[model samples]
Target: MMTDALTLLRTRKSPKVFDLAAPGPSPTELDQILAIASRVPDHGKLAPWRFIVFEGDGRARAGEIIAGVFVNDNPEADADRVAIERNRLMHAPLVVAVVSRADAHAKVPEWEQTLSGGAAATLVVLAAHALGYAATWLTQWYSYDPRVRAGLGLGEGERIIGFVHVGTLARPQEDRPRPPLADIVTRF
Candidate 1:
């Protein structure tokens, strides 16, 4: 099992587009996925990340919230521009909003807590991949928007790490360029 997992990790590729025509994980499967995703090395035992699920009609509502904010900010944007924001989450059947609720008052460094949130996001993607589904961690413009944050029910100090879109792949995934180990790694 360990060898298989390592092989999967080595070859896992993020698909560019998810198949909207196919079904996503069911509620039970998604619960399992989320459970696996939260098993990260969180220093100080601070589980600083929370997951928000968007599926079915919720995706459309969430998209409307994002597009509403976008249109308000960019009043001159055309219909196509507004539609792009409205359909942002349509790429996949399920979307998970990874919210970073890192507390500054914790004994752990805020940076570490924030990093734990990021790890949770990464794990969501990996867990989806291991489940025979494709996922991509995306932080589009809406993620940084204050109104969108409020619409998503995030607290003042909470921030979005990224949104993980998960579903079957619509097409083949292309392997992107990877840097050489020597260029990106160093031995002490």
Candidate 2:
């Protein structure tokens, strides 16, 4: 069991967002994924993160919001560029936007809460991989755009940690090179 877990962890890889195809996690699986993703460390018991799921027509709506923001920001952008922004979420069958709602807390620092949000997003990827799906966590320009944020109904205190794109891989992805432990690790 230990070896199996290790192997799953070692073999997990993030494919390019465009390489992710259709047939994402079913409704039940999505519920399981979100539940697993939420099981992260939270100091002060403050769950400072929430998820925004985009599927089917929702993805297109999000894309329109993104494209609108992009066009407003860059008037020189051509149709193709606008279309690319418009279809940003169409590549993946499902997208889960992890919003960090870190706020002022007497006992818990905002930084800790933010880290917990990041952990939640990371777990989303891991959970998808464990369930035989490909996922890539991304945060493009739209994530930080004020107009896009407003269109997406993000509150002033809330910020997007990432957009976890989950789907089936069109083809296998090769593992990228990792830094050697000797080069990075050190004894205290």
Candidate 3:
């Protein structure tokens, strides 16, 4: 595993459909995953991110919070759709919310700080995959809703980078389409 850096980089994929019944990273394992996540490049060493983990009952609590706000936002949404909101965090055994605490600072630009937070979120997905777990990073409408942000204790300047859902896969995810480097990249 240590020697397969290129292979792992080329093959890592995020899986959204996870095995809810399967156990997620143990406490120790999760700690390690977070440790790896914290290793992202940070301009000015601002460390502009923090993690909020939702596991077990925490997932349900978060779901309820988001679901209530969802119901309020989409009053026309039927019971089924509302119910889907309640299960958002339950799709995985563990969900981690990467919070971006980017703010105006002397040395580091807010954009760079925000990018560091995003890098931390990506690192989380990669760390989970390396630990034999599947993960997906998602931020839907609820992510930007002020009510949901209030429920997450987000401050005025703080924002959610994304939610990384981690667990075992219910079924193998086939590789999907990839963009051609020739089309997306150009030499300076």
Candidate 4:
């Protein structure tokens, strides 16, 4: 069992793109995934992360809002560039926006809360992979843009931790070589 778990962990990779797959997890399945993702090591019961699911027309609406913000923010922005930014959300059938919301009164530091949010996003990606879907966690320029945040209705203290895209694999992704373990670890 341990070996099987380790093998699964080792084989997981972030897919860059996905194919059109109907019957992606239903609402119940997504709830299960989010429930598992919520098991990250959070210092307090202050669930610092929230997931925003965007599908179908919602994706297009989000894209339009983002594009509008881009144009409003930069009057000189290229039209094609703006269009590309708007279309980003249309790439996947499902997109989960993971938001980090720090607690002001908690004993845990804000940094820890941020870490917890990141961990939750990672778990969501893994859960998608376990469900036989390709998943990628990304935070592009839009994630940090104030206009985008406003459009998403994120509070002042909240920030996007990641945008997880999930669907069937469009094509097999080639494995990139990894750094040696010795180079990354040092046992005292």
**What local distance difference test score does each model get?**
0.87, 0.94, 0.88, 0.85
Model 2 worst lDDT window (10 residues)? 141-150
Pairs in clash, predicted candidate 3 = none
Worst 10 residues of 4 by lDDT: 17-26
Ranking by lDDT: 2, 3, 1, 4
| TM-score-superior candidate, 1 or 4 | 1
Instruction: Assess candidate 1 and give its TM-score to the true structure.
Output: 0.95
Off by over 4 Å in 4: 18-23
| lDDT string, candidate 2, 43-66, tens digits | 988899999999999999999999
* Candidate 4 lDDT, 1-188, residue by residue in tens: 99977877898998674453444667887888889899999887889889999888988999998888878878898888888878877888888999999877549898898999999999998888878877888898899997788888898878999898877787788788999999999998
Candidate 1: residue 78 lDDT (0-100): 99
TM-score of model 2 (CA atoms):
0.98
lDDT of 3 at 111: 94
Cα TM-score per model: 0.95, 0.98, 0.94, 0.92
State the lDDT at 17 in candidate 1: 50
> How many clashes in each structure?
0, 0, 0, 0
Model 1 C-alpha lDDT per residue in residues 1-188, reported as the tens digit of each score: 99999977987777765443357888888998899889988988879889999999999999999999999989999999999999998879999999989887547888898898888888888888888888888897889988899998999999999998899887777789999999999999
**Candidate 1 clashing pairs?**
none
For all the candidates, what are their Cα RMSDs to the real structure? 1.3, 0.7, 1.5, 1.8
